[model samples]
Target: MTEYGYFLSCEEFTPAELVDQARRAQQAGFTRLAISDHFHPWNDAQGNSAFVWSVIGALSQAVDLPVTTLVTCPTMRLHPAVTAQAAATSSVLLEGRFALGVGTGEALNEHVHGDRWPSFEERGEMLEEAIGVMRELFTGQQTSHRGRHYTVDNARLYTAPEAPVPILVSGFGPKAAELAGRVGDGFVTMTPDADMVAAFRDGGGAGKKVVGGVKVCWSSNREKAVDVVHQLWPSELLPGELAQVLPTPAHFEQAGKLVTRDMVADAVTCGDEVEGHVDTVRAYARAGFDEVYVGQIGPDQEVFFDAYRELVLPALRR
Candidate 1:
């Protein structure tokens, strides 16, 4: 069964708003939750980046739904050991319903430490080593690791999870997908691409979960929704490795200027048309995703929840 989830955008919402969304998501029948981890918003218009670990603590109190970091970079900004501690604590708080979604990382969030952003290959190497270290720490036993990128000396997680925190690796291409298959408990990708899912499975992820997320706008006025998305989230339309390489929100804004409203209208599912919303989400399920998270892209969250609760979700569930 494919579980439907709500994605809490740390970059676009305040911590309080995210908690409320999680609560509403649970009430509306979303069985899981995914939250972004970012040091900065993609652009000022998106406008918010609360420390994700703090919000996760609040979420453990606000909702019973399982929470996954839609993705966090454990290799940079914070060491793998520290991220393991945070994930373990979250698991304890969420009563073992937490999963850690990790990735090679975007330079936008990971470059703030004054370290030169590494090549993607090096980042991949760093991530693989980081995962090994974090998994060792998750055992709640004393751990010491010395790898090419990180070193942990006789460290242990005192508050580790009773069960392993499933690590879902995020990737956009085949190489990263293959790495996820080898090292991750699951695979995370934003798009509904069966070929990519196949690549992961072929590489060793056959029985593991495949997770994905999408953003949509639900409104009576379709054009208005497009405008809202264009103004706030044009950053999503950037092609290629731009999302991974951009160093800051300013650079993102500069690039986002190329994303027009028409492009957003064509690319994103918008309006209150129930079928559009249902098809958008169902695409993930058809693509072999075991879980799919949907995020609403504006201020009118109440209506989005109401629509999904009474209409869209029911259709998708059927």
Candidate 2:
């Protein structure tokens, strides 16, 4: 059976709001939670980006549901060693209910430290090495490593979880998917593409969990919801590698101007029809995703959860 989850948008909400949402998600029958990690929101209009680790810690206390980073970048802004320590501590804090979802990262977040953005190939290699380093550190034993992109000398995680934390790698293309399959304990992506899932399995992700996420806007007023997404998350509709390469929120804002309300309406599930929400999630399940996380694009979260609890979720389960 596929697990259903809520996607927590750290970029758009405060930590307190996120914790509250987590509680509500659990109450609304979302079995898990996925939070995005970012140094900056995709566009300034979204206007918030909390430190994800701190939010995860609070989540450990606020809800019993398992939590995963929708995709954190261990290769850039922070060294792999620091990310490993943080992930290990999070697992311990969540009492083993944490999974680390990681990706090669975007310049919007990774370029903040004045480090030159590497090419995609270089980023992938760096990610593979970082994953290796993190896996070693999660063993709770002193670890040392010298790799192509990073080096760790006699580092250890003092607060490692009793069991190793599962690492879910995010991929957007075939190469990245293969990399995820080759090195990740599981796989994550935003689309419900069965061919992508098959590629992951064929590349060695067979038997691993396949996780996907979708963004929707649930409102009685469909046009208002479309407007909200158009204002807050137009970056979602940006084409190609723009999301991965855009260096700043301003750049995203500039590019996002091209995304119209019509595109968003066509792409995202908006408005109050329970059937639309159920069908959106069911697409992921039908594509063989083991887990699907749904996020309401704007502030209509309460309405979304209530609708899911009263109508959408039960239909999907049935």
Candidate 3:
């Protein structure tokens, strides 16, 4: 059996606008909401990265949608103790409706603080340590940690929720996935790729709740939707080695040329049409995703929501 729900992808809305979108998504029958938590947009060309925690706080009051950060970097840039406090407070504010999705760190986002991006092995270690710190702080007692990447002294969360926030670890590879299985109460990941799901289960996440999401261009006009998504998210077609070994965004941009509208459609269900979006979202179901979120890339979200509700959701509920 599969449980499917609607989630907002969130690139096209401002921090303030997110509250309204969350409200609308809930009204339209989406059981959950996922927001992209990014320190910076992949490039300056893609604008609108705001303080997401603040947005989450606002959404708590304005909408009933259960929330997650899709994934946050708790190891570097932000101290794990502080991240714990934020999650705890947010969880309380949402009436225990929030979950924390975490990742090691992304260079484009975490490297802005002049911290060296650690090797994958070191990052995996840092992630595990950070999870430990978060759990300690959530206990509502003083927490101290001295680790290779993070250190906190007598830090504690006073405004924690009655229940510790559920930790949903997100990962792309085996090591991180295994860590998530050991630490997370639930698992979160992007893409419908089954191998990634198997790796998470093998890593000890068996029977843990798994949530997944995908990106798409929402438009009634298929060609326009295709053009827009490809123009911005060309990273989809990157060859395996090129994505793994690339040193900078420039190299990424070069390999991104391999992306095309057809490839984007095949990998993700895209278009302004209602049928197209439903087909893409359902594909995640076929791949064993427990929850699949669909994001509308670029700004024009109101139209996307309306079309998705009228055309896509009705078909999906059946």
Candidate 4:
């Protein structure tokens, strides 16, 4: 059976709101929670970016649902050692109900330190090394590493989880999928692409959990929902490496001006039709996802959760 999860958008809500959403998600029958980690909102229109680690700490106190970072970039913005400590603390706080999802990271968050952004190939190499370093530190022993991108001197995590934290790798293409297969405890992506899933399996990911996420806007007014997605998440529609390469929220907003409401309507499930939302989620399951996380794009979260609890989730489970 495919477990259904709820996505907590850190970019769009305050920390308190995110914790409240997690509680509501559990009440609404979501089996797990995936929270995004972003230093900045994709665009100013979305308008919020709380530190994800702090929010996760709050979540530990507020809810019992298992939580995963929808994706975090430990290679930059913060060192892998620091990320290891945060993940370890989170796992301890959650009583072993935490997973780490990592990726190559985007320039929007990474360029903040005034460092030159490396190419995708270089970024991938850095991510692989960072994962290795973090995993070593999670064993709760003194560790030292001298790698191509980072250095660690006598780092040890005192509060590491009793068991190793499961690490999921996010991928969007064949090369990334192969990397995820080779190193990840699980694989994560935003699309329902069977071929990508197959690539992961073929590259040694068989039996590993495959996780996917989708965004939907549920409103009585379809046009208004489309408008909300257009305003808040136009970055979703960017093609190729644009999302990774964009240096700032201002650039994203400038690029997003080209994304139309029609595009969002076509790509996102909008309005009050429960069947459409159900089918959208089912596609991920059919593509062999072990878990599918659905995020409501705007502020109508209560309506979205109520509808899912009362109508959509039951249909999907059947």
The prediction achieving the highest lDDT against the true structure is 1
Cα displacement (Å) at residue 90, model 3: 0.6
lDDT of 3 at 81: 83
User: Model 1 segments beyond 4 Å from truth?
Assistant: none
Off by over 4 Å in 2: none
Residue pairs of candidate 2 with colliding backbone atoms: none
Candidate 4 or 2, higher lDDT: 4
lDDT by residue (59-163, candidate 1, tens digit) is 999889999998999998999999999999999999999999999999999999998999889999999999999989999999988878898999988988999
Task: Give the residue spans of candidate 3 off by over 4 A.
Answer: 1-11, 239-258, 272-275
Q: How many backbone clashes does candidate 2 have?
A: 0
lDDT at 182 for candidate 2? 97
What are the per-model C-alpha RMSD values against the true structure? 0.6, 0.7, 2.5, 0.7
lDDT of each: 0.95, 0.93, 0.74, 0.94
Candidate 3 lDDT, 1-318, residue by residue in tens: 455454544444577677777877777667788887766654334556777788888888888868888888897768888789889989998898888988876676677677777777887788888888898889898878887767889887879779888888887777767887888877777767788788888889898877888777776677777777777777656654343345455555666676776887666556655666777778777766777777777666787778777778778777
Worst 10 residues of 1 by lDDT: 143-152
Which ranges of candidate 4 are over 4 A from the true structure?
none
TM-score of every candidate relative to the true structure: 0.99, 0.99, 0.90, 0.99
What is the TM-score (0 to 1) of candidate 2?
0.99
lDDT winner, 1 or 4: 1
